[model samples]
Target: MEMVERYIYAVTQRLPQGQRIDIAEELRGLIEDMLEERNDGRPVENTDIERVLIELGSPAELAEEYRGTSRFLVGPDLFPAYLSVMKMVLIITVSAMGIIFAVETILTPMSILHHFVDLLISLFVTATQVFAWITAGFAAAQYFGVAPPGLSGGYNRKNWNPSELPPVPDKKKQIKRGDVLTGIIFSILLLVLVRFSNHLFGVLLFEDHHLEATIPFLNEEKLLELMPLIYLMVAIGIVKEISKLMAGRWTKNLAIANLVINGAIFLLAMFILRDQAILNPDFVQQLSDSWGISKQQEEYTTIKTVWKLSYNLALAAFVITLLIDTVTGFYKAFRK
Candidate 1:
């Protein structure tokens, strides 16, 4: 009876929301009828139930039968997840743009309608890109036979047995929705800032609360040359989040993939950061002049030394964070 319930859940959970209830009822009746016929005046055993379910086919296959002829780009198996991720990405993108719009409105003199129109255009363009990337990521996963937990998501083979069903993931080990949402938003926000406004990471000098000067941290020309590497890092981050979303829980393969992805990012960042030419050498000289320090003085030298070391500090900090995330992922995945 417990197996019976588990089998029913495995089937119905894969279906579209509107059809789940009715299909569950229909599948339940079908299973019962099959069991009765198999009973043959003898006591129905566990073997009897297993045989019946196996004959009825895998939950994924049964769910497909219930869905009937039509096919979907994401397919019914992944449509729910695809839809969920799509909504979050789109909402986060619009909200991020809206906040940027609000700030732009306050900082600069522009017609409200002008800003609003710009927001609309940016939203349309960004949303289209987001929608396409998300759809492609999910489709790629499905095409490659990677699936999330539960209904129609385990191993892909000609024979999918009831026993082969993946165990219900522990919540502690599961990929939390909060985490996935937060990761997606932050990743998108960070990408936007780096791609369009890297200059924002700099000192903004003010005079009597009125803006005066900006001392940019990075050499814009050098950064422009390195934009491809930066984009690569962001792209890797997006893929990592997508993998986490589809995995639905920690796993050995996921932990390893996480380590590899994080490691690649760290290496790429360090590669970029170690090239001190990418940093604005003018930053230290300009600040030193503001402090009234002469070029021949020890103070100026010390300031410059510390300025260069900042990149090293950033690289070290990133490595530590990477290790923490990777180790935590493995612990969660393998814990009893």
Candidate 2:
């Protein structure tokens, strides 16, 4: 009996607090009853107790049974209010994960696919955590008898059918004028910063030759020539922020559009660079010479090929990310 008590405690300890005591008490009574029935009129023994516990099955299984039925905010019931909240949370979490992956992919030499996979894993982890919290809250409410019957399980009311769920209110319609003014101000600031960054890089590279004098093949002037795209990126950012303040659906679409544009630019840049590298090995040789290095310093061909392949792979990843963003954005836009 004591051993059974210990086993039950070990198993139930993993469960939330609301039902732990009740479950433990019920299990204790069950084990005792089993032992008594097994022993009959004879004295209780270790073998009898073991048999009783075995008949009761594993402690883990028993704990699981006590967990009862699980429910999500969006189940067969399709409650509009609950589904709306869950959808919003999922969108926000996935978007944040995408942004994190994009920044990491841009700054690091990691493959785009690797970063994307990481993002998916991260989103899954976040979603699991959200689900766990919701389940725990529901369990606590049910155990304490605090939740109304309507919310405790799937909606069953004839008048409140899943197919007839009420339309979700557009919360963006409540935004005030101040929000628009703030967005405009941010847009202007972003544009100025992007333009200034391009000018600064241009001056440092072409006119001054400050940092470019130190590193070879890092053409700041060429990068500055790409500044129009950077400005476009700033405009996209402004649009995204404004859309988010106005409507979630619009925000998602804007984000996808921005990703598509950036991905396309990255792909074009990679293709041009790769073709140039292949067509003119002398270009690479010149870069080496400018850096006061010899081709024999390393396996020149192997190094150039590897670098080109890596660049191409990174570009491919951008395209894949853009595709994922577009699909997810579309899903969010129409899921309601």
Candidate 3:
């Protein structure tokens, strides 16, 4: 019956993936037996199925029985995504902070050591704020009855209809685990690389086969000042990918989400690269000098022109990547 299938879908959606199949089979058999006993092998009707379902109780109650417990905050439907998201955020945040700390210390060992306590405090404080915000967001989403498809979401759902059941996704539409994981890793790496570009990419000279002097290619203070904007971009990317992972499939909604996130990222990139001070003048001159060229030389002038256009170059790169990603995401999401 349609109602029986709806009830089964509801109950099974709230259960673990591994248990869903067995529980669905068990529920189907029990319902069949109940219907048989009720009508004495007479033609089954929606009325009979309704009565059986009523006896079995609401899907939530039945699922609670199966789970052997009740958990509303971060319930079964949201827990897996919640856990994976939390782990991803925490790991990336911690690793990024560690990279910054290492880079700062290498740049100025004594200075960083003097502010060691401050740095540690900042890391903990940032981590704590991130944790609280993520937990609160999930909690709010649950209370507000918002959730990904194929989930019970919240108690605000007054009815479970057979029509509400999600169709099994086709293989072409299914988002792969490797793809999601790789996207996340690449994003995290980019955030770190950009955040510490000044220290990571610098002019280096050696004397007697020993490292002698170095000049940072980018303006450290300027990049630090724009950290919040960079972080905002990273945050949007994380949300986009997390949604993809949860959806586990492509849809028009996913395509639209990808578009919005990509647009936002491009805007953020424009804002960040708008500041020309991000490149240090001293680094450019020093690099030119190392090549035995002065500012008046044609070669040095050409180098300066190229260096001054770093903003355009970086923005162009971002635009290209964003275009590719947006196009691919839309194509797959809307593929017939």
Candidate 4:
């Protein structure tokens, strides 16, 4: 009986100070009652106490039951918030993964379907972690009794009085010129940083002619080879910057314009490259030798499938980005 009392005290010690003594006393009384009924007026022993405790259940589970109907980790009220954040995060992550898969399919000679499956798995794992972290923070806050700072204090309930509510602000007062200008400047700086890093790497490591000819379109001897890529990059960057500065129908229009410009450049490059048969002779011979196709048939069928896929991928990327930008623009416009 003494051993049982000590064990109960030890288990209940970690509970809040206000809850500890009452829970401990109740548990002690229940154990005593159980022992009394079991012994039939005989002396109680340690084994009897142990058997009773075991039948009652684990101390941790008992503590959890006692602490039930209270907010700790994710309570019923906050589950929606947890699920909403998780859903939004997963959507964003999948979209980003799709963009990544498109780029990888374009640049690499790997199987597109296989890479896409791998990307989906990777995105799911990443989204799980992100959602876990978000929910964990909320759980931690509820456990610690610390409400998130700067959010509404009162719950939205039925019979809530309008007089008790704070005055609503004018919608027109929300727009700030300085805030918009700051966002535009920050966005431009980020784009500039990316461009600068790419240019630096291009000049230093990729300047050599030996590495240049390995890529189909980057060969120096190929006239106007890089014009398409340059035009596409510049057009996309400008459209992104314009969208940030002024969102609405105009932003969607700009995105469409960028996509059209990039598509045109890609088509022009394909026409020129195909006419010159840049990937014809050597690529055909390699394919025939590897696949056991006859040499005469190789010339007719062996095309630069990888290079063509890359061009198509670039066009696809622009279209996808445009679609995302257009949707986001309309969402923000309405949200404002």
Candidate with the greatest TM-score versus the true structure: 1
List of clashing residue pairs for candidate 4: none
Ranking of predictions according to TM-score: 1, 3, 4, 2
Tens digit per residue, CA lDDT, model 3, 164-247: 656677898888866776677667777766765765566656566644566677678887888888888887887788789777
| Poorest 10 consecutive residues by lDDT, candidate 3 | 148-157
Q: Which pairs clash in model 2?
A: none
lDDT (Cα atoms) of all candidates against the true structure:
0.79, 0.56, 0.78, 0.55
What lDDT is reached at residue 185 by model 2? 55
What is candidate 4's lDDT per residue for 149-263, written digit by digit as tens? 2122334445666665633533432323344344434434433333332222122223332222122232333433544554455455545444433332333454455456445
Model 4 regions lying over 4 Å from their true place = 1-41, 45-71, 111-114, 117-121, 144-336
Give the per-residue lDDT digits (tens) of candidate 1, residues 1-336: 789889999989988899888888887888888888889678878999999999989998988888785555678777777788788778777878876776555445347688989999999999989989998988887777576544245644566778877779788899987787787677766665555443355676667775455667788888888889988888898789878977789999999999999989888987887757677869888878877898999999898888779767876787898899999999998998
Off by over 4 Å in 3: 1-83, 86-159, 204-214, 305-313
Estimate candidate 2's alpha-carbon lDDT, on a 0 to 1 scale: 0.56
Taking the tens digit of each residue's C-alpha lDDT, what string does model 2 give over 138-209? 556545645543353434454556764534544442333354445545545534433343222122323242
Q: How close is candidate 4 to the true structure, as a TM-score?
A: 0.39
Could you estimate the TM-score for every candidate? 0.64, 0.33, 0.56, 0.39
Q: Pick the candidate with the highest lDDT.
A: 1
Backbone clashes under 3 angstroms, per model: 0, 0, 0, 0
